[model samples]
Target: LLLPYLRNKGRSERVFKDRSNPLEVLSEKELLEKFRFPRHAIQQLAFDLEEKLRPETSRNCSIPSLLQICVVKMDFFNISGFPNVIGAIDGTHIRIKAPSTHEPLFVNRKGYHSINVQAICDAKLRVLNCVARWPGSTHDSRNLVNSQIHDAFERGELQGVLLGDSGYPLKPWLLTPFLNPETAAQTLYNTAHAKTRNVIERCFGVLKRRFHCLHGELRMKPERVCNIICACVVLHNLEDQMLEEPALEITEAGDEDGSGHYIRQMIVENIFSA
Candidate 1:
C-alpha cells in the first residue's frame, strides 16, 4: 500500500494526447488567417527563438522580446507623396484589468482601464518602436515626449522626419497636420500627412488581430500587460501581415516648436506647393 501511494503521489492525473501541430497541418493562407503570420515567417521566428523559449505540456506560455527584422528599407515618400518621411507615430489604448494601486490613473477619457501604447511604424506597417508603459490617462504627446526615440531625435541619432497626428507636438523631426490650412500647399501637406500617418493605425489593427488577446482585456498585472503588449509587437513585426485602420483626433496646441513650424512651412512650399 505504501509503495503504490508513493508511485502515484507526484504524478499528474491528466492524460496526454498527441496533438497535430498547426505549423505542419495548416496551409500558408490558413496559417496567416489564424496565426496572423505566414508559415515561413513563423518557422523562422520559431527557429530564431528556439533557444530562448521552451514548449510546455500543460499551461500555455509566451515569449517576450523586442526583436524586429527590417526586411525592407524605411521609406514613406511613395505613399501619398509624403517626402522623406521615415515612419509614422501614434498612440493606442489597450484595455487591462484595473490595478489595485492608483486605479484612477488607468481610467482614460473613455472611462476604462488601459495602457497607452505608443508605436512607430514604417511604410511596410512594421513596428519600428513601441512604448507600452504609459497609463491610458496619459496623453499621446506626453508618451512621445518621454520615449527614448524622442531623445534619439534630439541627439541627431535618427534621420528623416516622422508623420504624426495633431495629438503630438510638431518638432524638427516630427511633422503634424495643420489645424487650420491657410493655403493649398498646407492643405496638401495635411492630406499627405493623413494618408501617410494612416499606416500606424493599420499597424495597431494588424497587431491586435494577430494577437487576439490585445482585442480583449488583459487580465494580468499592469507591468505584465505591458510586457505582453511589447511581445505582441515584436511578433507582429516578425511577419508582414495586413489589417484594417482606425481614426484620429486633435489635442494639446501649445507645444509646437518654432523650428518645427519652419520645417513644415519649407516642406509645404518646396514639395507640396508644386
Candidate 2:
C-alpha cells in the first residue's frame, strides 16, 4: 500500500485495505527479532519520526542533532583525562547504495560503496566527536580536511594527535606511525608511540562487536545512516558509564602511546600552533 503511494502520486488511501505499510519491510515478529522494539511501540515511534523528520518532506534535517538530543540525555559526557588529552580519530565503512552511474563516487580503496564514519574519543574511549558520511572514495586525510577537525585544529581546541591507524596520513594534528627510519632508534620510538595511540581501536572493536545494528543493512538515507552511527556512539558512551571499565588496556601502562613528551608533544605543538 505505502509502496504504491510512494511510487504513484496522489493515490487515495481508499484503494488499500491493509493497515500494514508494505514499505516498512518488517512484520511484527521480524521487528522483534531484528530490532527488539515492540512492534506496536515502534509503529508509533516511526510515525513520530516521520512527523518530525518529514514535516514537509522537502527540507533536509541533520541526523546528528536528533541523536544529540538522545545522547545528551545520557550521563556520559565527562570522559577522563584532560589538557594533554583528546580523543583519537578513525574511519569505518558502513555499507550503502552503489551509485547508478558514478560508481567511482562510491567505490573506496577498500573496495566498497560506503561512507567513512570518523570519530574522536577521549582517554576512556568515549566519543567526543563524530564525523559521518564522508565519501568512501576520500582518503582519511581528505575526510579530515573537509571536516570540523581542521577547524578544531585551527582554533587550538584540539592540541593533541588524534591517534589513528596507519590508514591516516601523517600530520601534526593527526598521528600515524613514524616513517623516519627503521633503524633501532625509530623502531623503538614507533613501538612506544603505538601504545598510547591504540585506544581508539579498542573503542572501535567494542563498538562494532557489541552493537550488531551498526554492522547491519542501513535502509534509510545517508543522513539517517549517519544518525544511526551517532546514536550508537552515544549508546557506547552510556554503556561506558554504566560499566565503567577501568583503563581499557590489558597490558601494563608503558606499552602503548609511545614514549612521553617528545612524540605526543610534537604532535600537539604542530597542530595547535595553527
Name the best candidate (by lDDT): 1
> Which ranges in model 2 have alpha carbons more than 4 Å from their true place?
1-85, 99-103, 180-183, 243-274
- Tell me how far the alpha carbon of residue 240 in candidate 2 is from the true structure, in angstroms, after superposition: 1.6
Per residue, candidate 1 scores C-alpha lDDT tens digits across 162-191 of 888888888998999999999998999899
Q: What TM value does model 1 have?
A: 0.71
Give the alpha carbon lDDT tens digit for every residue of 1-274 in model 2: 6887676766655674678753377777887887788777767655654443332211342223433333322222233221233446677777777745555776788787877887766556676666776767877767766765556464554334455666665555555665664455445445544655566777788888878877776656666777777667656765666686422111000013234335645544443233
Q: Estimate each model's TM-score.
A: 0.71, 0.58
Best by TM-score: 1
Clashes per prediction?
0, 7
Error (Å) of candidate 2 at residue 21 is 16
Each prediction's whole-model lDDT (CA): 0.77, 0.57
